[model samples]
Target: MIIRKDNLLLLPEVYLIIASIFYWVNTSTLFNPFAIIFIGVLLYQVIIKNKIAGLLISSVFILLNLYMVLALISELSEFTTSNNSFIRLLVFGVLFLGLNLIASIFMFKKHLVK
Candidate 1:
């Protein structure tokens, strides 16, 4: 099998798509159509290796993840001493969101350099 750069770049997009699916499942809401649309555009950018569009989408991804991380951090702090399922969920959210944020930043850098 051949693994190209574009294929490798699909990793973050796939992760975000899966995360969005989980978000929709858990929340039972389609209130964030903008994100869904952006993700579709981001996938297109990755497939075509469009540097400008990729950078723009990656910037939006990074900002959204950062905002989520900060919001989770604020919520987590309120239950720092608790040992509950919700706390565990928040911790995992923060961890995965941080990873997502880092991946987005790296993706953005790659687009910028190209």
Candidate 2:
């Protein structure tokens, strides 16, 4: 059997999807923050380079953030929660979304103008 080097590039993303699914199944709280950051970075990279990869990564990031946002909103009855942790999570999510959008726009413009 011959090995293809191109397939190796997808390994990390595949692994992350699997792990994220497992974390969801286990109702593990620890995975959300890490997963969000990981997916964010991956999305940023893809957005700056590959359209197909960027679409895939961005979709996953949005889905994951939706889950996290719903969880946070549910946990806190009011938006004004005294918990710093929840505030940080919310801030991070918003920032990630903004950064991804900015990166994507720049990438698109760069490619279009070239």
Candidate 3:
């Protein structure tokens, strides 16, 4: 059996997906906001196959992750013994967790894995 070069890109995705699930079950919430950003970067690197395009996407990706961080903090601050806050936290948390899983898998066959 021969291993292809592009398949190497998938190595990180699998690891990321597993780690994200672990973080979810353990309530880490660290990777919640930026998972999509990672996916975006990987997708561009693998599929776009253009350094310039990847750089542009990465710039936007960083800004978006920053936005997510700010939003998470803002929402968390209002979560003081309130049902609404708890629900928002759960919603955002689970949404990102799921996104992390999908993002990793979605990059599986992209240019990164070509």
| CA lDDT of each prediction against the hidden true structure | 0.76, 0.55, 0.54
Every model's TM-score: 0.78, 0.36, 0.42
For residue 66, give model 3's deviation from the true position in Å: 1.3
- Summarize candidate 3's per-residue lDDT along 1-114 as a digit string, tens digits: 887866764554454445435545566566565554554455546555664544454355445545666776687777667687587786876576456434443443342333
What are the per-residue Cα lDDT tens digits for candidate 1 across 18-107?
A: 666666566667676865675677668656878888788789889988898888877777774778866777779867897788778887
Model 2 scores a TM of 0.36
Model 2 clash tally, residue pairs: 0
Q: Which candidate is the best by lDDT?
A: 1
Q: Where does candidate 3 stray beyond 4 Å?
A: 1-3, 10-46, 82-114
Q: Which candidate, 1 or 3, would have the higher lDDT against the true structure?
A: 1
